[model samples]
Target: MQKRRRFKQTKTLGQRLAEEVTRLRDQARALPPGRSREMLLRKARQDETAIQIESWLRSPGLRAPT
Candidate 1:
């Protein structure tokens, strides 16, 4: 049997994702308009969406099915 390695994260998932989105946007801004730039922007958008989803999931207003 193999043991799974586990480690604690110092920051919440939202914080990490927000950081990545900021980094991606900065990188994209430095690049000229082209496929590569578009890709970076797309990735940033994806990360932003993930952040939104995570917040939604953690919201106290959300309720599971009865």
Candidate 2:
């Protein structure tokens, strides 16, 4: 496994949301309308980040990470 960074500069709420949206859109564009990859390993991090963003948006008490 890759070692995680001990500390990193976090992005702003808007920036994170935008990045997620961008990644999802890119992934969508990379696929065909009627077909999809059997195992989409492409942009996995982006896909995960986008899902996290979606979940955050659904939580009423969620706050921007500090």
Candidate 3:
């Protein structure tokens, strides 16, 4: 009998941030308008902004000139 090996894959920072944003937005939608809802929406926005920034930072043109 041969042993089988499994490999685990890890999400990049951008992917993780995007998933978090999606979760926050879903939670906010389910809640009634109030402080908690507002907070969750705000956090989702922040995560979206972070994702944009991360994409910008990773863009090819921004790399230091070699």
Candidate 4:
């Protein structure tokens, strides 16, 4: 008999944020044109922008001020 090894699941902040952005976009797309849908889409855009900024900040190519 062999026991299966279980690995702990974890998500990084960037990954979690990216997932939220995806979920929001999906939900927004499923809804008809309305104020609520607009709000969700806007939120999704904001999250996506944040993720981009986070990636940029962590980029190895980025240089500090001289």
Best-matching candidate per lDDT: 1
**lDDT at 45, model 4:** 88
Model 4 per-residue lDDT at 50: 88
TM-score: which candidate is best?
1
> For residues 1-66, could you state the per-residue lDDT of candidate 4 as single tens digits?
999999765986689898999999999999999999999999988988888778778989886534
What's model 3's lDDT at 28?
Answer: 94
**lDDT digits (tens) for residues 1-66 of candidate 2:** 999879664976556666765666677678776435323434555566776777778779989855
Alpha-carbon lDDT of model 3: 0.91
Off by over 4 Å in 4: 1-9, 61-66
lDDT of each structure? 0.93, 0.64, 0.91, 0.88
List the candidates ranked by lDDT, beginning with the highest.
1, 3, 4, 2
Order candidates by TM-score, high to low. Answer: 1, 3, 4, 2
Error of 3 at 17 (Å): 0.7
lDDT of model 1 at position 16: 98
Backbone clashes in model 3, listed as residue pairs: none
What local lDDT does model 2 show for residue 42? 41
Displacement of residue 33 (Cα, Å) in model 2 is 0.8
How large an RMSD does model 2 have? 7.8
At residue 34, give the lDDT of candidate 1: 100
Range of the 10 consecutive residues with the lowest summed lDDT in candidate 3: 57-66
